[model samples]
Target: MNKHFYQKCIASALALIMFFSLFAGANPAKAEAALNINADGAILVDGETGKVLYEKNADSVLGIASMTKMMTEYILLDAVKKGKVKWDQEYTPSDLVYKISQNRDLSNVPLRADGKYNVRELYDAMAIYSANAATIAIAEIIGGSETNFVKMMNEKAGKLGLKDFKFVNSSGLNNRDYKGEQPQGTGAEDENVMSARAVAKLAFHLINDFPDVLKTASTPKKTFREGTEDRIEMINWNWMLPELDYGYQGMDGLKTGTTDFAGYCFTGTAGRDGKRFITVVQNAKDSSGKGGYKARFDETRKMMDYAFSNYSKEKIVPKHYQVKGQKTIPVIKGKENEVKIYTKSAINMIVHNGDEKNYQPVLVLDKKKINKDGKLTAPIKKGEKVGYVTVKPKNGEKVSFLTGEDQIQVDVIAAQDVEKANWFVLMMRGVGNFFGDVWHGIASTVKGWFK
Candidate 1:
């Protein structure tokens, strides 16, 4: 048997296997089953891609408590970033804000009526310390009133496309004991409610849009006016930071929330080797009252460990990916012999570890549209979408790299322009191609006779 013939037979067999594999379904290598977390609602997502890695009751609506402050910070920080508010500008806390800060039932930074705090100081206290009074004070400064600020928070939620969330107060605290100027359209019964997924989304936006929030949230401790007669020291409650467990590397800043109604909630973020993840755990019970804080942190750590251990960011089709099999398509009348082609945009997917090799990128050319007899008629424009490169798993649809549901199909496009060929050139090429085909047919017939 001829070596070429043997190779061809093997190639054909492989193609058939692939064709059936598409319909037969893939058995992607499985990771260890996701760990069961002790939380009423939870989610873990890739920070860069917004890919959900783990979720349990993530969409269940419940009181979000101080997680509400993530929104308030988003709104207020956006205002500050937009020059609508100034960091150095001082604002006197209202009687209501002073009262809330002083309330023993809630977490606060102890703001006094006589103490003049700047916008930056107030924001730090609210973000790092979860100060209800400071949050409300910032709201009044930015939104002109607490009620209007609540409206702004809801509006921002709507803009973010949050499905299961509502904000009734700037702070996540319950409103029963609070007697201040309520926003005009608000009532005491209203409280901030959202799902774990919604809170994750909010965290995503906060870190994505305003990375500076991470800087403030990650600091374990900071003194606003150090060595001063009126200095105030603030400490971050997020224990995932390096100061606590330096081995829990890349653990950075994010907010922690807890209340009688919301339980213990945390929106945690961490990065390692350029990969970052955002995790949310809401309504985690303190099985033992002493371990309440540790419960939520442990749950977050479990999810993050699962994610970092099992998953990685992979490029589905790279930005500079050149079409492998066919770089150029033959042209009938174009001055150039062929026009180069490529995909329009880069595609990325979060693939489980060790499954990268299973992804197979198959090029499906538009034969009917582009070429009937191995020649495409020109004038071909640059960047014209021509075909598709489908990235499928070797086993099938069941184990596809993209979220394990859909195969990633990327558009194949023309890379450059091809001008029309002149009449003489077209006639000459036509004659050459005709004779070439006849010679090839005769050669094939001769080979077949020997076989």
Candidate 2:
């Protein structure tokens, strides 16, 4: 090869190497390490933002056990809010609920065959004690039948954007546990199932949309039918409550589940020092393969520890901040040739401590407002939303939100107005552009002839 050709080739190779190096810099120095959560599926997320901080087999479908009540709770709360039901409304036990309630082997706050219970009492039993019969009773009240309630559950799951879920019953029990009287639409052997991620999403919405649910969920114990002979002391199944033995500080208001098919599962939430986290551990087990109530809480504790110890709500992108290379965009036919742009609001999310430096802001402009040359034509208004800015890890590791929504972002807006140029100025510019194009065409032809 000639010397000039070899030089060009070396220069091209160097350019390619530099280009790859720039992208490679965005990758983390090491692969994302797992939390080693001992469960069939597990996930951890910031309670307020719903930003997923960690996950393990989080998308895998598995039995949810009594954690299924969270959905039932959600629906019932929605019904109450819409005035479709009232806390003082009375309920008469159905044949199925009576039979299930009498089964002392399962979780229950036994109901008298002829007893009349109100909505608030039934909800207390269902939420705190994981009472299967009470859950069914509430389901019946809202949907007119447990079968219809299951449909509502599935439909609501779809509306919530839940992925990997199936609701066969209001209570998270294997249908066979009901003998031949399972809810109308479900198979005899079917059980409620949800991915850890979906369960977290359910819990997220439950707490956010109906914050009052936490008031009852956090109750360590409550009396069902207090002052009546049928009254029962309903102890919460969630051992992590502040008044419980394994109680972690700031722990409160969540659900726990256990069944032969589902093993042990818990959807837990805790808040401390102005930060809150939601965690899900499904089918948790120990090294000996023994799964039980303690195992689920233990796994959840590990996740919470990881979250509280390592992650915190940090303002990764500040309001009015400008991206390094995208501080402004070109404008056409405007008094100003360019308009400055910045984030409309600050973006705060759960992030690992010391890892904030790895995130970089990326500007995404709205294509409808910009022309082919990537220039916006005036007149632009101040604070107009021109696009949005999202942040991503430099290491290319995927960061997901619990709701399966887009990553948290801030609006990218014009910082000031860019008025359209005067008519005379526009005409003058048009003439100048026409002459400039003609001169460029002539110059190109002459240059090609010389070549």
- Scored by TM-score, the top model is 2
The ten-residue window of minimal lDDT in model 2 covers 23-32
Task: Give one digit per residue, the lDDT tens place, for model 1 in 1-451.
Answer: 8999999999999999998754333232222244777888888887875666677787799888898899999998899889999999999888888888788577777777888889998888888888889999999999888888888998999888787988888988877647745556766666689988788888888998998888888888888656767566777778888786432678886888887778888889998877999988887755454327888888888888887887877777875456676777777688997888777777666667766666776667787657667667888888777777767666553542212233366788888898887889999999999999999999999999999
Worst 10 residues of 1 by lDDT: 23-32
Per-model lDDT:
0.79, 0.89
Candidate 2: residue pairs that collide: 26-394, 27-395, 28-395
- Could you give candidate 2's per-residue lDDT for residues 298-361 as a string of tens digits? 8888888877987767888999999998999999999999999999999887777667777888
Error of 2 at 173 (Å): 1.7
Q: What TM-score, to 2 decimals, does candidate 2 have?
A: 0.86
Error of 1 at 30 (Å): 11
RMSD in angstroms between candidate 1 and the native structure over all alpha carbons: 9.5
Once superposed on the true structure, which residue ranges of model 2 sit more than 4 Å away at CA? 1-35, 439-451
